[model samples]
Target: MIYKVPFVEPTKNYRMIKNEIDAAFFEVLSKGDLIMRGQLKQFEENLAKFVGTKYAVGLNSGYDALHISMLAAGVKNGDEVIVPAHTFVATASAVVNAGGTPVLVDVGKDYNIDVTKIEEAITPKTKAIIPVHLNGRVSDMGAIMTIADKYNLVVVEDACQSLGGTFNGKRGGAFGMAGCWSFYPFKILGGYGDGGAITTNDSRVAKMARLLRYNGEDRETGEYYYHGFTCLLDNLQAAFLDIKLRHLPDWIKRRRKIAALYKEGLEDIEELKLPHFDTPGFEDVYQNYVIRTSKRDELANYLKKNGVEILIHWPKPYYSYKALELKDRGFPETEAICREVLSLPMNVEINDKQVEYVIKTVRSFFK
Candidate 1:
C-alpha cells in the first residue's frame, strides 16, 4: 500500500543561505558585537517598513513581546484585560505577567474574538483588549476599535500568526495601537528559531519597548536605569529572518491558492465544516487551513495511519489551562471548535500533488 506524503515542509534555502549565515556569523565574530549591533538596527528598520510601523522592537519570544506591549499600554495590577477564550495561553499570560487580570471572552464563528460580547466585559477597571488573529484570520478590528473608542480601552492586536496578513488595506500589525508578532518556526514568516517583535507607530510606546527589552537601559547613557527582562533578540536570527522576509509575498500567494483548492475540494463535504472567509479585502495568508468536524479524532487517526500528517491547532483553549483556568467558564462554541478543529497540510512548499493526496485522504476517511 502506498502511503501519503508528509504534511508540511518549510522553505529551507540552505543552498543559497548556508554561506550567507556563515558570513554573518563570522562578521559578528570579527566585530565582537554579537548582542546589539548595527545588524539589529537594520533588521528593526526593515521590519518596521514592512509592517508600516514607525518602530519594531525585537524580543526573545512572542510572549515577551506581548508582555512588554502590555506594560507600554499601562495594563497594571488588578486591571482587567479582555481576551478571547479560544487563543493560545500566551495572549492571556502576557496580561497576567503585566499584573493585569485577563477576562476570557467567547469567540464567534470566525474563530476570533466575539466583538459583540467584548463591550459587555468592559468595566471601569478594564484597561486593554487583546484581539488574537487566530490561524491568520483577521479579527473584526473595525467593530473592535469602535467599542474600544466608546469605552476608552487600548487595543493590542495579537498578530503572532498573521505576519503577512492584511485587513482593509492596512497590515495586520498596524491596525491597533500596538501589535505583537511571533517568528516561531511554524509561523508564516518564521525565523530560524524563537523570535518576536512589537510593532507600533506611537513613538513613546516604541521607545518604552526598546528600553524594556534591554533591562530598561538608557541607550545613550548605556546605563541600567530600571528593571526589565533581558529579551533582546539575537542578531544571527534576525539576519536569517531578513532573508526569508524577501520571499514572504510569494509564499503568501501560494498559500492563498492552496486554500482555494481546499475550499473547492471540501466545500460540499458534509463531514467537515470549512472555515469562513467572510472578511473581504483582507489577505488572510492561510497560516493553517483548519476545518471542524464531529469525527475529529477518527479523521486525525485515520490520516496519520495513512501517512497523511494532520494536527489540531489547539486541543485546549486558553481557559482550560491549569494556570489560566477560569471559574465557571462557559463557551459552547469555543469548546465545540476546540474538540473539532483540525489543521491540514498548508505551506508554500506544499505541491498540488500533496494537496490532492490530502483531499483524497480526508474524503476517504469521511466516506
Candidate 2:
C-alpha cells in the first residue's frame, strides 16, 4: 500500500545530508567519546544560541526535558499544572512523571491552549502551566506570560514542533521560564535518533536540569550528588543534530513556502478550514501542514484510495485517555478538532509537484 504521496518522509531529508551525517558518525566513533563529551557540549551551546536562551541542557527525549523542567520549577506532589487537552499525551504525562497533577484545559481555534480559559482552571494548588506550541505555531506567549506573572505560576513551553518558529521576534523556546524540545526524527529539527533539550534563562533551573539529565554527578569530577536518570543524549546523535541545526533556517523556509502553497491552493474550498498563518507577531515553521474539514473521514479514505497518504495529528483528545482519570471532564473544542483536523504531507523535502498533486486530489474530493 505504498502511496504516491506519503505523509512524511524522513529518509528524503536524511539522504540529502547523508555525507555530512556519515562524517559526523565517523568523527564521534573515532574519538571514542559517545557520552557527555565535546560533541554534546557543542550542540548544547549551539542550541542555546539558536533559541536565544542563556543555557540549554541536552537530554535523551523531550519527555525527560518536560519532567525535569517541572521538577526544577518546584512542581511538587499534589501540585496542579495546567496543560492543553489537545496536545500529545507526553505534555500531561510529564507533569504526572514529575509528581504533579496535570490539570487539563481546553484549546482555542488555533489548536493551542486558550489563554482565556487558563485562569479559571487555576486553583490554590496550581504550580505551573505547560503551553504546547502545536504544529509549529507559537501560542499566545505574551498573554500567557502576563497570566503567569499575575498568578505567580511557572511556564514550561513544549516547543518540540516549533524549533524555528517565533512570536514577536522572540524564538519559541525563549518565552517561558523553561522550554522543552524533541528531536524525534519527525520533528522540524530532527536528529538521527531520540534527543531533547531544555532551554532557560534561569541559571539555577538550568543547573538542576543539567544534573537531572545525568545521574546527578559533577561532570568534571564524576562525583555523585543525587539520584537521577540516564537521560543523556548520545554523542553520535548530538553530532548529527549539530549538522542538521546548521541547515535548519533553509529547511524552515522551505516548509513555510510549502505551507503557503497549500493555503493558496486549498483556500477556495468552502468545506475546508485552513491553519491560521497570518496571525500578527507570530512566525510559523509549518512542522505539520494541518487543515480541518467536516468530511474528514471521507476525505482521508478518498485520498488513500487515490494513492495519497495523510494522518490525523491525534484521533482523540489527550484527556480522553483512561489512565488520566479525566474522562468526565469535557473539552468541546478539543473533541471537535480531533474529529476534523487532518495532516497533509509536510516536510522540507516535499516538492511543488507533490503539493499540487495533493491540492488537486483534495479539490477533486469536493467535486
Candidate 3:
C-alpha cells in the first residue's frame, strides 16, 4: 500500500543532500581513513561546538554513549540510575549494561520525566538521572539540576531526539554533567547508520569516555590502559553525520512548522491532546508529532486506511517484558500514555499538502 503521508522518507532526506553525501563518501573512501580517523575527529569537534560542550567523544551508538558516560561517571555495581519509563529501552539498558539498576520514574503531561517525581525516587544507591529529551522537547533541566545537586547525583542526558532543542536558552546536553546523543537514521541529527556521541564540560569525563570507546587504548603511545569496549563511531558514518549536521538547523525549523500545522488543524478536537511546541524558553524540534486520544487504535487504523501512515511509539510499557522483571513497578502515567499516544507522520520531507491531508483525515475520523 502506497502512503500519501508516510511516517518518514529517508530516501528523500538523503536526496536533499545527495551531492554532498556522495562527495563525502568519495573523499573518505579514497583516503582509506576507515576507523578513528580525521573525519570522526572533525565531526566530534563540530558536534561539541554545536552542543556548547568543551569536548565530545564519538561512539558506535547512543547506547554506547550512555553506557560509557555511566562508566566515566562511576556508575558501578549496586548503583541505581533514575530514568523515565516512557523512553526507548536503550536508556535503562545502558544503565544495566554499566552494572547499575534502572530506577523507573513517571513522566508529566509534557511526556518528559516529571521533575516533581524525581526527588522522591532518589535513594542511597541512586547514582545518576538520565533525563530523556524525548520527542524533541527539552526536559526541565533547571529542576533536574537542582535535584541532582541536592542528592549529588550525576546527570547524563538522553538527548538522542533533541539535538537542536533547548530550554531557558541552554541546550539539552549542555546542562547535564554529560549528554548522550544518537545518530540512528530517524533521529534529528541521524547518520546513514548507527552513531552516537558524549558531550561534556568535564575534561575528566570527556577523556575517560574517549578511552572507554576505543577499548582503553592509548592510540598515540600504543598502550592498553584498561579493559574497554571497541565502540568507536566509524569514520565513514561520522563523515555522513558531519555533512548532515550542517543542515540540521533548517531541518529543525521545518519540523516545527509541520508541528504548527498539526496543532492548527487538530487543536479544536477535544478528545485529541497535542504537544505544546510554543512553550516559552523551549525550542521543540518535534522529533515525532505524537498526539494522545483514547481512541488511538481506531484512529490509527482509520489513518492508515486513508493512505496517511502513522506510528505508535511503544504501545506498551518497557517493563512489560517478563524477563526484565519490572512488572511490579508500574508507572500510571506511562501506562496511560502507552494506551493513548499516536504519532502522525513527522518527516521533514512532508509537504504542506500532505500535512493538510493528514489533518483533514484525522478531523474526519473525529467527526
Per-residue lDDT of candidate 1, residues 158-216 (tens digit): 99988877778888888888989898888887877899999999998888888888889
In the range 1-367, model 2's lDDT, one tens digit per residue, is 9888988788888899999998998888998988888998999999999999999989999999999998888888989999998998999889888888988888998888988899999999999999999999999999999999999999999998899789999999898889999999999888878999999999998888877777897787888876888898898899899999999999988998998899999999899999865579999888888899989999999999998899898987767767777533578889899999899999977789999999999999998
Where does candidate 3 have its weakest 10-residue lDDT segment?
A: 321-330
Cα RMSD to the true fold for all candidates: 2.2, 1.1, 1.1
Output the lDDT of residue 257, model 3: 92
lDDT of 3: 0.91
Report the CA-based lDDT of candidate 2 relative to the real structure.
0.90
lDDT of 2 at 214: 78
Residue 63's lDDT within candidate 1 is: 93
lDDT of 3 by residue, 187-212 (tens): 88888889999999999898888788
| lDDT for residue 13 in candidate 1, whole number 0-100 | 39
Clashes of each: 0, 0, 0
lDDT of 1: 0.84
Model 1 pairs whose backbones collide: none
Against the true structure, candidate 1 reaches a TM-score of 0.94
- For model 1, the superposed segments whose C-alpha errors exceed 4 Å read 1-4, 10-33
